[model samples]
Target: MWAMVTLDGLTVTYRDRPTLHGVSGSFAPGSLTAVVGPNGAGKSTLLKSILSLLPIAQGSLQVHTPRSRIAYLPQQSAIDRSFPITVHDCVLLGAWQAAGALGGLSNAVLDEADAALHTVGLCGFAQRPISALSAGQFQRVLFARLLLQDADLILLDEPFNAIDSKTTAELLALVADWHARQRTVIAVLHDHSQVHQHFPQTLLLARGVVAWGDTAEVLTPQHLGQARLLGESWDDHLHAA
Candidate 1:
């Protein structure tokens, strides 16, 4: 598989405090990679750095996608539910950025947005207001937006944080389909069990790279312990079992 996004010796800081330090990794096409760590582990920061949402203090980061080649699905908490927007409108917003000045949305863009909603099993609620959606349903709307982006790389931050089992399963299946279609997925996940169950590759971060390898191997007790106590004792578990 081709490398879609590559980061070498990447570093990021907030308020002069380093959040990501000397992180390096590569994401390939048709791959599902998970970023796992405890709170304040720089999981979200890493994704932001990749999306260029945050500036990199050092190191090199390369993205192979075109304008819409990479899409983002922010965490539910990041979304403002009070916004008076319909599900259809929200989904259509994905294409608005790419829309031409021909007035209304193009047929192709509308079709794609409809398909995205359908893919997430929210076709029936397309006209419903986003504020009326449940936590899981709201997430599906975001996923639909991701689908509408038609990007080869999708970045999701804690996508499964507060959803029910059924919705989580549905979202995972959608991600699997994208993977099958040769799209690359990078998600920040807190649930270790979900990482073990769904993602094959894992990037464990702790203001730095704790481990970056196969999910089963890197997410061991030592790494967990080190991640749990990142600022104080990452070296202790740097090479520990």
Candidate 2:
């Protein structure tokens, strides 16, 4: 498989504090991989840095795919549901890349949006307000949006955090579908069981990479223990410019 994203000695800082330090790895094209570690392990920071959402203090970060071809699903907590938008509109937003800034959606795009909603089991919720839906339902809506994106690379951060088991299963199926389509998928996950079950590759981090490679090998007890210790010992006083 080809490398879709590569990071070499990548370092990211927040408020003069290093969130990711000398992190190096590559995400293979068409592969399903998970980023897992203890709290403050820089899991989310890695994703953001890949998307160029954070300032890279040093080192190199390269993405083979174009920015327009990338789709991102941030953690639910980062979204504000109070925005006055219906589910249909929210899903339609995914078509923005194709529709362009002032381009209007034709009947075909509308049809695709409807189909995406149905695929995610949100057919009747198209006209429903985003603020009115439960956490699980909103997640489904986001999935529908991603469906319309047809992106080459998908990045998900804590996708199944608070959802029910059924929802998690349903969402995992969509992830499988993406993998089957040969699209690259990288997700930040906390559940070791889920990572072991679905993701073939894993990258363990603690402000820096503890291990990276096959999920089973990288997630060993020793590696996990070292990651936890590194995360716990991270000094907030270390300043990086």
Candidate 3:
């Protein structure tokens, strides 16, 4: 398998305190990886570091995407809630990387955005103001934007938290389609059962990598116990093995 993202001895800090410690992993293309860990385990930190959104405190991380290779759905909390951008404009921004700094979007880019909105079942809301969207709808808009980006590696933070069941299903289906097309997916998931059901690979973390491999291997009872000990327990039985 082709490694789309690799982390070696990755460490991060916030306010002088370490968040991630000596983490190492290689994310392969055409595979879905669920990043599961207790709160404060640095799942979001890891993703941000890989995207270069946050400064790396130590270690090394690399994302290998061919030109237009990476797309990201940041934590909902990070989004500007009061921003006045419309859904269509938000999705259109996905093509900005391809458009470069000086170029305007082409008709093809708009078409791609439309297709992405349709895929996320949000086509009709294209003209709606972003602030008018519910949390779930907002996430859908981000997904639409990701589709427009046509990236090889996709990273999502807490994707199914507030979405309706239908939207959740659609997102999973879309992710599966991306995997089928040889893209890599890394999602920070809260639901252990859902992680096991939907993602073949799992990364169990607690300030560092507790274990990473097949879901069955990483989500074992021993690791769950450790995670729970760290007060990160949420449905420990769901991932017990």
Candidate 4:
């Protein structure tokens, strides 16, 4: 079978400078992979490229799943929590495409939204406005929405950034569940230890692929140091120019 997502010399530029340079890799079907690197290592950029949110300056990205079967949870910082929407409403939006096309949500879909909320440990939060939620609670809400999406290919950016240990463990369990069901899940994460414990496959990057393979092999001290040095080199080169 073909890979679920493939990148052949994928490159992305920002303000005429390449942020990601000739990055190439493929995510196998049902693979759970973590994208890791320094702050500006183009980790987030890769996720955006896969989602087609940003223009690719060169090469190609092929996501085998259909648009509707792909779900994305961007950084919590990017969401406008001030929007006047209830938690239930936010979760319900996960099924909006299908519900809209089908005229309305079926009762079963509505129940699924509630179940998603409950699964994420937000059982009584359905009627609360999202603006009132704490950062951890809000992240749970996002996970609940992802669950409702029931997507085949899920891309998560910084999924556990501000989450507490309990919340992080709960969310990670959900991620594990997704893997068990043969869904393709990719997340850009910062915590190497967390990635080591949870993700079996890793793509360590520094404006390009430093290492791509088993997490145990990719997150090595030497590889990590090299990634950091590459990031610093980019900074130094830009300062000189």
Candidate 5:
């Protein structure tokens, strides 16, 4: 498989404290991979670094694809649901790249947005404010936006977190569709069972990479235990020491 993303001794720090410590790996093109680890293991930090949203403190990270060809869905907490934007408008934002600064939305784009909303099971929610929707509904809206993005590389940070099982299944199916279309997808997930079932590759991290390979080999019990230990041993007060 071709490599879409590569990290060489990549490190990221926040306020002079390291969150990810020298992680090295590559994500295969058109592959579906799951990033799993205990909380505080820097899973989200890794994603942000890949998207170039966070400054890299050390080492190098490269994406073979262009920046505009990547799409990201951050953890729900990162989103402001209170923003007074309609569901339709929210999804339409995906077209900004294609529409450009002075370009207006053509009927084709509007129709596509409507169809995307329907695909996510939010047909009549077009005019509704985002705040009026539940966590699941908002997630669906985000997915609709992703659909409009039509990107080559998709990064999802805990996409299934706090959502209902039905919603999870729907979103998982959408992920499957992306895989079928040969899009590279890397998702940060906590559900071991779900990851095992859907993701063919797995990267187990603990501030550093514990394993990176086939899902079965990477998700071994020994690696999981080590990841837990690594997360537990993190010292937030180290700076004060």
Candidate 6:
């Protein structure tokens, strides 16, 4: 059984500066893992490295899953809702690998898109402009797109940030469904209680890995404290230099 993702001494850089340093870990296929850390801990950077959206400055990062079979939902703040795209078109973009640009969507693909919208409980939102959506509703639209992709490996960056409780619960159910169906799900999250309640595995990082393994074992107070200290020390060093 091959791992879904593996990183060996992985160091990633952005804008000519290193963001993640010598981090190494592998996520087992079909596991649901939460990545937690304090601000500036490289949580999102890890996901970006997996998606090949950033440069690996040192060591190796591998995704055993094919590129096309991978799906990513970046932080909502990264999205430009001002773009003039409708909800239906935005969700359909998930099938881009299957339905090429300018290639018409097959009936089956169309059905899947519609079903994905329904799954996200945005039944009548297909025609709505994304600019008009609330933050929670926009997040739902992103999840609907992921559903359409049917990805084998899913990476979500801060999936539930700034959303209402009801919306969070609904999206979390979708994540659980993906796990039950044997999809590999790695999410960057900050809510410790949510991570404890829903995720079975945890990766606590601060520029480097503090701990990674069973959720209970890795998120202990000592490990959490170490991560905090590491983050603060890194900040202090940056300031000193």
Highest-lDDT candidate: 4
The Cα error of candidate 6 at residue 76, in Å, is: 0.8
- Judge candidate 2 at residue 231 and give its lDDT: 68
Clashing pairs in 3: none
Tell me the TM-score of each prediction against the true structure.
0.91, 0.96, 0.91, 0.97, 0.96, 0.97
- Candidate lDDT scores, in order, read 0.86, 0.93, 0.86, 0.94, 0.93, 0.93
Model 1, runs deviating above 4 Å: 101-103, 231-241
Name the runs in model 6 displaced over 4 angstroms.
Answer: 15-17
Specify the highest-TM-score model's number.
4
lDDT of 1 by residue, 1-241 (tens): 5588888999888887778888887988788999988766788997787788899899988988875677888888887989999999899878865875555888888888888888899878988999998999999999898878878788999898888999999999998888888888999988889889889999988887889889999999999888878745544644573
Q: Write the per-residue lDDT of candidate 2 for residues 1-241, one digit (tens) a residue.
A: 6599999999998887888999887998999999998888889998898798988999999999899999999999999999999999999999999999999999999999999999988878989999999999999999999999999999999999999999999999999999999999999999999999999999998888999999999999999999988865664333431
Off-target runs (Cα >4 Å) in candidate 3 are 231-241
lDDT of 4: 0.94
- The candidate with the higher TM-score, 3 or 5, is 5
Tens digits of per-residue lDDT, candidate 3, 1-241, equal: 6578889999888987778889998998787999988777888988888888788888898887754688888888888968888999999999888898999988888888888888888868988999999988888899888888888788899989877888888888888888889788999999998887889999998878889999999899999888767643433533682
Better of 3 and 6 by lDDT: 6
Per-residue error for 11 in candidate 4, Å, reads 0.8
Quote the lDDT for 4 in model 1. 88
lDDT of 5: 0.93
Q: Give the TM-score of candidate 5.
A: 0.96
- Return whichever of 2 and 6 wins on TM-score: 6
Q: Give the TM-score comparing model 6 with the true structure, all chains together.
A: 0.97
Q: Candidate 4: which stretches are off by over 4 Å? A: none
